[model samples]
Target: MRAISIPLPGGPEVLTLGEHPDPDPGPGQVLIEVAAAGVNRADVSQRLGHYPSPPGTSPLPGMEVSGTIVALGRGVVGRSIGDRVCALLPSGGYASLVVAEAALLLDVPDSMNLVDAAGLPETLATVWSNVFMLAGLRAGETLLVHGGSSGIGTTAIQLARAHGALVATTAGTDEKLAACERLGAVILINYRTEDFVERLLDATDGRGADVILDAIGGAYLDRNLNALAPRGRLAIIGNQSAARGTVDVRTLMSKWLTIHGSTLRARPSEEKAAIMASVRENVWPFVVAGQVVPVIDQRIPFAEAARAHRRLEASEHIGKLLLIP
Candidate 1:
């Protein structure tokens, strides 16, 4: 099997494509003959030596993949070889073959191809777990997503809108904001030129956002608190910015706000399985009905993984980036 490996933790240049042994499925796992993989910010962090794959997991950089099942390990049931599935992988997705937990596998929708399905697992699981399950987002409420042009943010906006919630998003450019608007974002804030806290509050008539999905952690913490409505939930899924920051204890206590943070890669397999089940039940219908779609910015050959990393690091993309194997 050909795989992308970070021989040394440094930059995109460190990624090397070389021959590696094919991974075999362990108990409760499935081996997938990879067709395509999703590129994520977490992959960037891993390449730069900032994030490390969990102990006992593969050291490769990809987090999600779409492919066909070639074999199932012991204890796996209800799934078989020849099934077309997209799965959330802890690591090793940047290869011609990878092994994933069977429970984390999701059936590809009839309307989507395998390549597009590659982009769905990580972002879909992230948004559904953070925004809907953890924050308890409900209909008629206001949901605010940071980095609206991002794969996760775009997915969040469409899913929240599909659930009948008003969506607000912040981006750095006019073009990015327009993309968000087309995805049903009612309020678009240009973070480079305006204060998102003020714009979000004013858009909701001072009510602020009931649920806020944030990727920029500490850099926006203070402003995020100020922008939250009473009883609001702030779900932090990434720390793209600096991770350390001071919190205003008074505001948190007075407003009764909740700040929750989670990382899907490090979680137990059973938890990811539960989240996938919820996504299939609650979110798959929206995908089938055309209420949600994969927004891809670019597709690169698997051997050119470094170029994909460079594109994502430069922040030039509008949505998910895929690597075709």
Candidate 2:
């Protein structure tokens, strides 16, 4: 099988395309002939050798994949061979073939193709678990998403809007704000120039957002707390800025706010399976019904995985970058 491997920790130049042994299905797993894969920020970090794969996991950098099931492993039922499934993978998605847990597999809607399906699993699973499951985002409330032009942020905006929440988004430019608005964001703030804290208060009439999906951690810390209403929940999914940002305990106590931080890859397999199950039950229909869509920024051939990594590191594109294997 043809696979793209990152041989060393460095620039995008470290990635190489060549033949590797095809991975086989293990217990409760399914072997998929990969068609398309999603490129994520985690992949970029992994390529640069900042984020390493967990022990016993594949060294390649792909988090989600869409493909056809060729075989099922032991104890796998309810799914069969030849199913057109897209799944959230812990690792090893940048190849002609990869294995996924059967429970993590999602049936691609009839309306979606393999490429779009590839873009859905990772972002959708993360948003569904963090925003709805963990944060308990309620209807008739206000929600703010940081990095609104991102794949996760764009999906979060649309989903929160669909569920009757007023959405606000923060990005770096007017063009990115426009993209966020087109995807159902009710308010947009250019974080690079203006203060998002003031905009959030202005949009919500001084009440602040009920919940926030934040990826930028360092400089946005105090401002994010300022933008939250009393009893607001802040779910931190990524630490792109500062992994060791200090927080004011007094602000947290006075506001009665809840700040949560997590990384999906470090979680146990059973927990990830549960997240996938919840996404399938609650979020899959939204995709099928067209209430949510994969916002693709670029689609390049799989062998150009190095270029894809470079594009993401430069932060030049909005929404998801996909590779067709």
Candidate 3:
């Protein structure tokens, strides 16, 4: 099997394709022959030596994969050889073969191609867990998503709107904003030219957003607080701009805002499995109905993994990027 390995992790140049032994399924796990893997900002961070894989997990960068199940490990049930599936992985997805816990697997939708399915697991689980399950977003509420053109952002916009919430999102360019609008975002904030806090408040008649999904961590903390409605929930999943920032205790106390921070890559298997189950039951239907789809910018060959990393780091894409393995 061929896999992309990061020897030292300084830049995309560190990623090199080389022969590696195929992974076998362990107890309660499934062995998949990978067809495609999704490239995420997390991968870039890992390449730059900022985020390391969890202990006892593969050192590879990919976190999600779509493939055919070639074998099932002992104790695995209800899944079999030759089943087409997509799964969330703790690591090691950037290869031709990877092992994933069976409980975290999702059946690939009949309506979607395998390449597109590769883009679902990470974004689906992240958005569903943080935005819906953790924040408890409900119908008739206004939800604001930062980085609306991103993989997580695009998924968040559609899922929030599909569940009956009014969607507002921020993107840097007119093209990205237009893409967000096509995905059911009613309020579009061009962060390069306008203030998202003011735009969100005006769109909601000065009540602010009931739920806010933010990836730009400390840099947006103050504005995010001001953009929230009383009792609103704010979920932070990434710290792309900066890792540390100060929050106003007075504003938080006055509004009674709830804050949540989470990372999916290092969670225990049971929690990830639970998130996958909820996504399958609640979000898969939307994909099957064509209400939500994976918006892919491009697919690069697995051997050219370095280019994929550069594409993600450049922030030139409107959605997910895939690596054909």
Lowest-sum lDDT 10-residue window in model 2: 239-248
Question: lDDT for each of the candidates?
Answer: 0.93, 0.88, 0.92
Candidate 2: Cα lDDT at 15:
82
Which is the winner by TM-score between candidate 2 and candidate 3? 3
Off by over 4 Å in 3: none
Candidate 3 colliding pairs, count? 0
Collision count for each candidate, in order = 0, 0, 0
* Best candidate according to TM-score: 3
List ranges where model 2 is wrong by over 4 Å. none
Rank by lDDT (best first)? 1, 3, 2
Instruction: List TM-scores for all candidates, in order.
Output: 0.98, 0.97, 0.98
Cα lDDT of model 1 by residue, 1-325, tens digit: 9999999999888999899998889999999999899999999999989899988999988999999999999999999899999999999999999999988888886678888889899999999999999999999999999999999988999999999999999999999999999999999999999999999888899999999999899988989999999999999998888768679999999999999999999898889889999999999889878889989998899778889999998888999999998
Q: What lDDT score goes with residue 3 in model 1?
A: 91
